[model samples]
Target: MSEYRAGKAGINAEAQARINSKYNDEIAQETLEWIQKITGSPANTAGDAENLYEVLKDGTLLCHLVNKFQEGSVKKINQSTMAFKCMENINAFLEAVKKLGVPSQETFQTIDLWEKQNLYSVVVCLQSLGRKAGNFGLPSMGPKESERNVREFSEDQLKAGQNVISLQYGSNKGQQSGISFGNRRQI
Candidate 1:
């Protein structure tokens, strides 16, 4: 905790930040690996707080705290799935911002500056947390989060026989025709 006058980073806080940097990464990475094994889900900061708030509009500088599932004060990833972890992360981040006592309802708040200044420290610690063991990708969205395949086709696609529906009878010419509801007029 030296009193070096690091720019922007205050003197006292800078020392503590460096000291924290020493061990936080080692522990965080270990936890991340453990989380990956039990749940088979990677510690991904892929949504909401990490995505919207932590990240820059140009998709740069994602904040570390945004990854609540992995890096939150509360443990999120485990054998049990947290369906509400996204909201939890968002609330956690916003609550932290509010606690900062910055009264504003716009983009680029004090929190952004707070996060940016401390981002490297947090990121080093988090990245030091390292990745989970296996090359696991995102977890399955489960039945609720899974998307249903649409069985619709335009007139052209239908006749294209992407999915051919054969209707053959005993004595009929081998022919295929798409069902169409053509406009008909009667006199």
Candidate 2:
């Protein structure tokens, strides 16, 4: 008899449902459209997470997508059907996107895309890349990238701020509540 797989079906199903719930068809569709527009390649999905995975699993189009932002970002695009080759392509695309200013936190792992474990994370990474694309004057799909607002305070202003007791410091104003915890209710 085969050894019993502990917590296999139940745990896997719950985790799968949780990951599925995080996926947004609309966002996937928008990401697909944006990728198609940028790479000039037609995707074969209807914007669903599964379709999106199929469209990006090979990582070829992703490499092309990053190249659009920075020429030759991914110097070589693999054309092999082997698993490692496909993962290499994904890694190349990820590294290229990182060079293009996509935050490390925003990018998903190779297995996340390869195994289809977390397609939502893939979509989120694409959305983050789309937002970062705006920084390069490209037509972005998601929200525009926020511009850095660096404020330099003068010495006098800094000194003035030090003298002020901000509300965040919790000034009680010498007041105390008459309530107590862990006591029986008083009727």
Candidate 3:
């Protein structure tokens, strides 16, 4: 009877391990799908897998959910208002971090590296989870599109506004004549 009981327990343990593996696999698949959807990038690097695992392991899932909710709420608020609130959250987190007296440089360096790798969404999500776990004062700054130098504008040669100006194209001017503007309307 003892031998039979031992066998049963071993079997149960093995089954449990399999279940855990399957669950992990499902989570990974879901996370990959999410990343692909968000980034519109087809290829997945090993770094992406590791990063996703770290995020889920470190209680960042909660933060992602919180961000989703925040985005939904922002849908109701005007873009400008929502942007202001996001900026406020970022600044508030920064101030709170300083008040907590942690090494600001180290914390910022970690955040900066993650941002440079385009992992700001994950950082934001993880920070949200950290806040809920009584680890408040984490700065949750998402990546700004401006981090990349690429810019977009209407292809039409003619744009008119009080703040708008015209660019005269000459063969003498190469890419330098890219029609630079200042204090121009964002519209």
Task: State which candidate has the highest lDDT.
Answer: 2
Candidate lDDT values, in order: 0.36, 0.84, 0.37
Write the residue-wise lDDT of candidate 2 on 49-91 in tens digits: 7688778888998998898898899899999978799899999
Q: Summarize candidate 1's per-residue lDDT along 1-187 as a digit string, tens digits.
A: 1135354457857775675454443434444444344444444534322332233222112222334233443333222123244334433444443333322342232323234433333333223222321222323121222246889779998778756655552444554445347845443
Candidate 1: pairs in clash: 29-129
Root-mean-square deviation of Cα positions for candidate 3 versus the true structure, in angstroms: 21.8
Stretches off by above 4 angstroms in model 3 are: 1-9, 21-27, 35-52, 71-187
Candidate ranking (lDDT, best to worst): 2, 3, 1
Q: Report how far off residue 72 is in candidate 2 (Å).
A: 1.6
Overall local distance difference test of candidate 3: 0.37
Q: Which ten residues in a row have the lowest lDDT in candidate 3?
A: 72-81
Candidates 1 and 2, the one with greater lDDT? 2
Worst window of 10 by summed lDDT in candidate 2: 1-10
Angstrom error at residue 122, model 3: 16
Kindly give the stretch of ten consecutive residues in candidate 1 with the minimal lDDT sum.
56-65
